[model samples]
Target: MAPGPAPGPPGHAAPDLATLTGVRSGKRSYYRAYVRSDERMQRAVRAMDSISRALVRTVEGPRGLLEEVARAAAAHLDASWTILALSDGHLRGARPRFLAVGPDGVVTDDDAGLAPLVRRELGAIRAGHATRSDDDGPWVRVPMTLEGRQIGSLVGLHGLDAAPEPGDLSVLRILANQAAVSLHTSEQYQAGVALHRRAQRLYDEATAQARDLEQRTQELRQAEQRLVLAHQRELIDTERHRIARELHDSVTQYVLSAGMAVEVARGEAEELGADGTTILERLGTAKQLSQDAVEQLRRAIYALHQSHRDTVSTLPELLHEVAEHHRPQLQVQVRVEGDVVPLTTDADHEIARAVGEALFNVATHARATRAVVRLRYRADELLAAVADDGHGDPVELSRLLRLERGRSADGRHRGLANIETRIVDLGGGIVFRRARLGGVRVEMRIPLPLTPTDRPGVISGLVGTPGDDRDDRSGDDTQEDPWPR
Candidate 1:
């Protein structure tokens, strides 16, 4: 065992009482000092109170406690190495990181405990038991406690020349106790930080997954539109063929009879010889008009077949019509970027109508002086945007779409439903947002040659409803003007 404190001349006053009470040990030395000393116990208590306040103010948690104790021990005892260690529920480190100091006045982590006396002393400190080594001035360890609960340890090596007096040892124990409380607080704080990180990771992963799913859904919708377009074109061709047979059976007979009547009248006029020239000219003009109708029908059939040879439409021609008709002062712009496959008739029709609707919405809602229209032909679909510079929030576009459904004056309403429905039918959609110009903006997209296989049930469900047998005859009359004053 380590040698006891040498019997002292006069009473040995403790150098630091804060350490003694904090460690929950070494009360006997203080009790003896209080009883025989001329100074009252109150004076000792007052001095310790000041030291305790200072230690508490500087400490954070167990880590702070351990560090403070080690620094105090190292400076007072003048030992080459002083260390304090505590586990954070992990046992991997060969030595604890709570605190450590090495010989030669240098602090290092890799030091091994070579003396059993030191090990036993440290073990007792962690276990809330005070212990001393066998050397004359050996290492001492004492457990730091708060409210009777063991938190960690305080350790110090007593150099041969710097053995601690009873009062000094008591002060060291008190510091150890305070350190234990700080360590517990720090551990709890670390645990909270770890949990916050885990939660953030989960949120990021979930957001990525949602975006992936939305992209896949858009692709599927585009494919379905291609399939519906093919079916509609085929049906239109069949209906035209049927109409051709009807024209041959009914119209051809009527036209031939009428031409014969005209010929007979012309002959009569010529035989009469008075107004032959005028009568003959009238007959010829009527015959020419009849023939022109037949030729026009023939040309329409050729125009329909031309799509098979060249699948793309002349987009500039289509937009020119809308631009030509647009109101003055509103600049309608159309820019085609690259080569893209021609969209089906329905897709083309729906896109055009949606764009027109977007323009209408802009004209009524935005009070901007100028507006811009943009069209981009990607490899897959047609993207069109109608934007105005009146007022626009770049993101709050969906709310505007809802407003379009509501009524203003005269109970009149804006028809966003037409735009949305048509966009959806073409395997595309419209989204409203702030335009680059500072006004309301509307974007419309339609996939080319959309296929039903992309959305198997959709084309079958929407195009051919339960009682609808005449798909060949069904088509939108979008050629007619939407607004007629």
Candidate 2:
């Protein structure tokens, strides 16, 4: 409509200026469209790179990954402030862990104004609703989800000059979803560790209880053994008491009655004049022996029972008494070979009784004209022996003392068995050997204190050996005294 172009050479028409202007405007439109497309592609590539970096932080655990997500979302969305809040009800009395990024890089607030909006997004996620931007403010909240369950919320605050686009919201959603997965994995690991610790504690307690039960079992076994030993001791004491009663009632009474009979016979023989003098003297001796037997019986009964506080006589005097009483019945000589010492009551009684039993064996069993009673007192021990000039076998006497047979036909074996029992009970020793007097020797030794005491007490006598109760009158009637001067 304005000017015309000059026509070119042959066949060319003149160009219109309006047509040239329209061509230039079309080229400008194409250049503008190409520039806009290139910018959009660059933005897409950056968002993709941000999401890849946030996912890589999941290896550092849930808390670290959450922090990374906040930073990445802030840069990608161009926000003035960003917050990532996690709320897992598993922790005791736990509140949400909140992380934020601001213009200065990182920021935190306990009571932030945007906290309510973040919590609301979390509620929406739990309620199965889509997370969206707020219409009232330049902020956006997106749900953090794992396997379709909401774990927390991701909230971003945009600057006054910056508003979020659809692409910005999409990048935040990817970060929140990856954070939820990391949180779930961390929770499972913590639970497994707790369960292992609990199991170990239970095993330790069970081991301690087992040890206690084993110790209790051993104590019970020891207690049971002690009870068994106590019961055995009680039975032995009961048997000892029964034997004491039998000797007191029967044997003692019989010996006393026999002594009375011998006295009566002596009286009757005295009426026969001069011929009865020898018979009366022999009867008198028999009566004396019978009384001695009765005394020995009483002592044996006492030894079998409990001790008493009654004072006793000295050891030498007690032995002399036994010799003096038995002299009329048998020709017995008393000999003392060492210094005399006092002894405890039980030891004194047992030693004197053992010597008496040896002498009685010579009188009742040995066919000898004379016998010797030797008492040797030493610093450490008291030794006593009785020997005869008869033919008693030492081996046979030892067998009888051991009670190889219950009782002899003559009832003499019981006496020697009693001697063996008494010697063993007193912790003494006994032996039978050939004597210097050419007959059986019954020797015994009793221990004494290394240092003598001032206390003095009497020794008691024994009745007879086990095999010598029945009188054997085969020895000659000759009487001789071999006692030391």
Candidate 3:
């Protein structure tokens, strides 16, 4: 029309100076078009900025990021209402599967507060009845896709005077696709956190169970040790009672029979008058010695026969029983000078045997009439002493004990040797001293905190006659004996 617009090259449109010059070319129609294009670009820039902000808002979690995306779409389309929803079967782990923004720009996960059109659109999206919209109606729908698969839609009802262009639809698609990728990432993060919590709980339970098992194992070990000790004690007691039975049935009867023979000989010697005087005197002495020997054998048998079950479990109570056995022939008294200390059962038995040996020597070789056994408990050691009123020399007895220990085992002074061995095995010492009661005093110093060795039958083997065989001696000749020949 003004020489007409020059025909542009082939299919290219004629360039508009209004776009290059902006407001400087004040033609009314071109200015209006320019203003429209500028506003659209500004809205697109704002929409892209919203997507950028939403992408970085992962710390606010999936729901917050989704809401931000919804608001960005609404602003881009200049919409009065908007809906963002995942299809029912898609992104099942994503929370708040549906999101709605009202005309008032209020965000909500539930569709109840949305406008009727917005709520209807959300239901359609959730029910899979809606897809990306391509109509010229006021409504616009774009798919939010992940890896090219449509998971949900971003729907909007615009309130603008102009319809959204193709460029506007492109911005909405970008925003929707970004929201899909972000939601998928949020679902994975949540799954990892839940798995970590469950794993920690199982580890704690396993640790507690292991600790309980260790404690029970230690208790079982301690119980096993106690059972072993108890079984050993039972065996020792059974052997002691057996030895007692043999001594009483065989050796005791032989000594009594020998005493009877001596009495008969003395009566025959008396009938011969002065011719038999010296022989009668010798027979009387032999009879007295036999009686003494019989009393000593009875005491030994009584001690061996005493059962551990029949008495209290204390050293003083055991010493009292030993004193009672010796009381018939020699007046024996037991005194405890301090508080009683507990010791191993085997150690107590050995100490009691040592004290009984001392009393036996007092009754036989010491020629003592009375004896006292004292147990004095001290800070570091136990003082067990046996004193008697007799005519025995301590020096001679101590010398004999040293000689017996130094020499070979020939069955002489076995009692003194046994006393030394018992005390020494218990980490203690023994001494023979002059008694305040006018005879020999045997003192045994056993160290305190006495945990005796587990040797069960050591002291039991030392009982009865030193050299004689203990196996059934009832058939042996009683006339060929050591009682004054």
Q: Largest lDDT belongs to which candidate? A: 3
C-alpha RMSD in Å of predicted model 2 compared with the true structure: 19.5
Q: Tell me which of candidates 1 and 3 scores higher on lDDT.
A: 3
Q: What is the C-alpha lDDT of each candidate?
A: 0.56, 0.64, 0.77
Ranking by TM-score: 3, 1, 2
Question: Which pairs clash in model 3?
Answer: 1-4
Candidate with more favorable, higher lDDT: 1 or 2: 2
Clash counts per candidate, in order, are 23, 9, 1
TM-score of 2: 0.41
Model 2 off-target regions past 4 Å?
1-61, 87-98, 102-104, 107-133, 159-170, 219-237, 243-485
Give residue 285's lDDT in candidate 2 (0 to 100).
89
Worst 10 residues of 3 by lDDT: 464-473
Best by TM-score, which number?
A: 3
Query: lDDT of model 3 at residue 142?
Result: 88
Model 3: residues with Cα > 4 Å off, grouped in runs = 1-27, 50-59, 112-116, 129-137, 219-234, 247-401, 412-485
